[model samples]
Target: MVYEIGDNANSALKVVDRVTETLRGDQWQPTVSVNEAREKVRIFVKQTDGLVDGLVVMVVGEADKHHGDTGNEAVFVNIVGEIDPAELGRITKKLNIDVDV
Candidate 1:
């Protein structure tokens, strides 16, 4: 049977969900901050394979109250633990984001 556009989209979503579930296990979920004007989700990702220490990622809303005018920065953060600043900077650069701890 030929799949319609909607079917393809749904299949893609399912695939995405599966990938997310698989990858998310290694990454910690963000904690919500209620007091802040905009809710911020902070997650700490522990390093694996004897790499450097974990890093923190903050997911904030796109609302102006969250200090995000473009609302494109769904994830923001800086490196934490035993890691090099330069390395973190490189990663942030690759991600097209400015890391803030």
Candidate 2:
């Protein structure tokens, strides 16, 4: 799933914090990475009974890298494998970003 959570770097970091902490609380270990030059944050976790097991990639930078706009972001979540429907819903809720479709 892909979500737009605004383009504020601070907010993006907060989102990363919330996600990691929430997963930790659920006993799911998460590996995190941050790319300074590209302004990207990445997270990986194993799917657990109550946690998402997937890779989360957050890119924060100019929406129009070619001059469209500035400060834009897109977050992507890649589920590593199959999971229960309910678990998927729970994961989305934790991410806290609304899906338009």
Candidate 3:
């Protein structure tokens, strides 16, 4: 089932914590970690017939830049299945613009 993560910061943090624990376990080893301060995170899951086909975690935030440099940053995590990379890109774009992703 699709779960819409709540908009509250605490809710987002909770989801991140749960996902972190899951990733730390042997069952699910995330390819990368983008846990950072003041970042937005999105978890995408594509499912069919009650079975998950793909999963992606995206994190966006301001880049750590030198003086006078524009700061921009983005992170995309693909967990499983054959979900389109472009689709994940679109989701990330939307999440970057939306405060309540």
Candidate 4:
């Protein structure tokens, strides 16, 4: 399960940042962080030994959180490929997120 981050594209990207902010050290290599649209963003991460070679993570948020949203939560997170669970857990813990795989 994922967390209800926020509404709108910016919020979705912020979630990505929150998850990646601590992805430092020689073991991690972030290739790019790009905004595909006003309401979407994608981030690619590559482990030194090439653990993840595809879309590391991407997020898409609703344009209008209040249009038909009652709870106003519209952030969507998509993670592709795989990473070391222990490393991921350490990162998530610092971000106040839970890791369960």
Candidate 5:
């Protein structure tokens, strides 16, 4: 799975494709971990159609504790089988956002 912190929908989807492809294969568990700098980060994966048709990726991040706001942010992405690295690269370039891992 792809791990990223995007400010919008399009960029978040691109990050998912990029991360999923980079860690392809059964041995690679779909997981995303936000660094300690982030107050909180949670990733949830739900398999649809018996894990074949596609997957739902949900990411949630909490506001920085120092900011005095306890709100949270979230991003959701739906992915079909196989990701195109070229396409992902293009989105990454356009969005200018970094994938966590």
Candidate 6:
């Protein structure tokens, strides 16, 4: 579900939106916040999953740097505990994002 470096930003927004909606009302708390200066969104998701209290998934993304340059400026998402990495990977792949968890 990857998109071109110069592709649809709306799709990214939708992915975040979907993820947010899916999290609502669950014991897991998904925090969505933005950094206006960077034009990026940061997501922090955590869930107990009836196992232990910890993180679930962490993801981040932003437009690719211009002219092939590496741009550190991008969206960020972080998940901290025992979670389904496969599902998280699916979300990131679709969103064309990167994360550190």
Estimated TM-score for each candidate = 0.31, 0.46, 0.38, 0.38, 0.36, 0.42
Pick the lDDT winner: 2
Global CA lDDT of candidate 3, please? 0.52
Tens-place lDDT per residue, model 1, 1-101, is 11222212334334334534553676743322222443333344556565657665444333453453533234445565777645766765565444453
Off by over 4 Å in 2: 1-7, 35-38, 47-55, 61-71, 78-80, 83-101
Better structure of 3 and 5 per lDDT: 3
* Model 5 ranges off by over 4 Å: 1-32, 37-57, 65-70, 90-97
Please report the TM-score between candidate 3 and the true structure.
0.38
Model 4 has an lDDT value of: 0.47
C-alpha lDDT of candidate 5 relative to the true structure: 0.45
- List clashing residue pairs in candidate 5: 2-19
Q: RMSD to native for every prediction? A: 10.0, 8.5, 9.2, 9.3, 10.5, 7.4
lDDT for 6 in candidate 1 is 24
Of 4 and 5, the candidate ranking higher by lDDT: 4
Kindly list the per-residue Cα lDDT of model 4 for residues 61-85, writing each as its tens digit. 4445446643323333335567564
lDDT (0 to 1) per candidate: 0.45, 0.56, 0.52, 0.47, 0.45, 0.48
- Candidate 1: residue 15 lDDT (0-100): 38
Looking at model 4, residue 83 earns an lDDT score of 59
Native-to-model Cα distance after best TM-score fit, residue 6 in candidate 1, in Å: 22
Q: In candidate 4, where is summed lDDT lowest over 10 consecutive residues?
A: 69-78
Per-residue error for 5 in candidate 5, Å, reads: 16
The predicted structure with the larger TM-score, 3 or 6, is 6
lDDT comparing candidate 2 with the true structure:
0.56
Q: Between prediction 2 and prediction 6, which has the larger TM-score?
A: 2
lDDT of 6 by residue, 1-101 (tens): 22333344555556656766665645556544554432455455555544434433323345445646343332434445565655665765655545432
Off by over 4 Å in 3: 1-11, 23-26, 29-32, 40-52, 56-82, 97-101
